[model samples]
Target: MKFIIVTGVSRGLGLGLTKALLSSGYKVAGCSRSRSDALNELEMSNDNFKWFPCEVGDATQTQTFVSDACQWAQAPLWGLINNAGIAKEGVLATFPNVDSDELLQINLNGALYMAREALRMMLRQNSGGRIINISSIIGSRGYTGLAAYSASKAGLDGLSRALARENGRRGITVNSVAPGYLDTEMSSTLSDSKRAQIINRTPLGRLGTVDDVAPAIEFLLSDGAAFITGQTLTIDGGITN
Candidate 1:
């Protein structure tokens, strides 16, 4: 069985991806800041799933988590999803004491750290692998109160592109998925009118679901996408188009 490692699997898209991957029969090692009751339930029923508590922002902890996960799976890692991120909202100039440093650490640096460690494992295994970075539509387009979040995701996209070039010949592919406004908990603060405005602008006339994003990720990691790399697959219901 293929072994995959996913970070931030406690809730939302992360949880959805974990379930989807597990159901698809991949041996999954997932981590979050805290244990989720939902993931705990999956563990009780699936021997192929393993959970770990990890603060992805901490380099040491992330390294240890990856090491332990690889050892537990006892197989060469096949794929990695850097899905742990924080959505910090604030205007560019005056936003009540927004910690700029913390924003970069969690969203950008955390993904970088995880990709770095996962790359090490993939390289050592000598098997081609996939690395999917979860980015955002806002990463490409700017918004009023999300400068930090947008910047982090933009950095992630750039990093993925660079890594894809660096690792392609080594049998590894790195790509990004940028999702627009979805019904995830991260977007629950949108007012009804604002939500409607977004939906109306989208060609699909609806907000996306976690399911919509997960399948794109699965495809990118599949053999059919072997020749694709250094690209961002935008699943925005045509909002960006």
Candidate 2:
């Protein structure tokens, strides 16, 4: 079985993607800073699913997680999904320096660290693999009170692009999926009026869902997407349009 590693697997898109990948017959090694009941349930129900505890922003922890996950899988490292992130809402000037640092470490530096570890394994195996960073539309479109979050995501895309160039020759493709305003925990803080405004502006008339974005990740990992690299796929409800 092809083994893929996913980060931030406790909830939201990370959890959803883990389920989808397992159902599709991929062995997944997932990690989060904290365990969720959902993670426990998935492990109990699916032999293909296993969860680990990890804080992606910590370089030492990240290194250990990937190494341990791969050892446990005992399968070819096929892909990696850098879905671990944290978002803090605040105006740039007022946002605590500590909070901004944490956001960047987790959202951008963490992905880079995860990709580095995954690429090392993939390159050693000499099998081309996929690295998909979970970015946000705010990276490109921008939003109020999320300047740090936006900067982190924008940096993620830049990481994807540069890594794609660096590794394309090895058949390893790097890309990012930037989902629009989604009905997920991350976007739960939107006020009622703000939520309504988003829905009205979206061409599809609603927020994006985890399911809506999961398949795009799956496709990117498939043979069908072998030629695709360094691209940012926007899976919004045409809101970006």
Best by TM-score: 2
Report the alpha-carbon TM-score of model 1 versus the true structure: 0.97
Clashing pairs in 2: none
Lowest-sum lDDT 10-residue window in model 1: 92-101
Q: Which segments of model 2 are wrong by more than 4 Å?
A: none
Candidate 2 lDDT, tens digit per residue, 1-241?
A: 8999999999999999999999999999999999888999999999888898889999999899999999999988999999999989988888899999999999999999999999999999998999999998999989889999999999999999999999999999999999999898988989999999999999999999999999999999999999999999999899889
User: For model 1, what is the error of residue 19's alpha carbon versus the real structure, in angstroms, after optimal superposition?
Assistant: 0.7
Model 1 misplacement above 4 A? 96-98
**What are the models' TM-scores?**
0.97, 0.99
Clashes of 1: 0
Q: Write the per-residue lDDT of candidate 1 for residues 140-231, one digit (tens) a residue.
A: 99888988888999999999999999999988999999999999888999999999999999999999999999999999889999999999
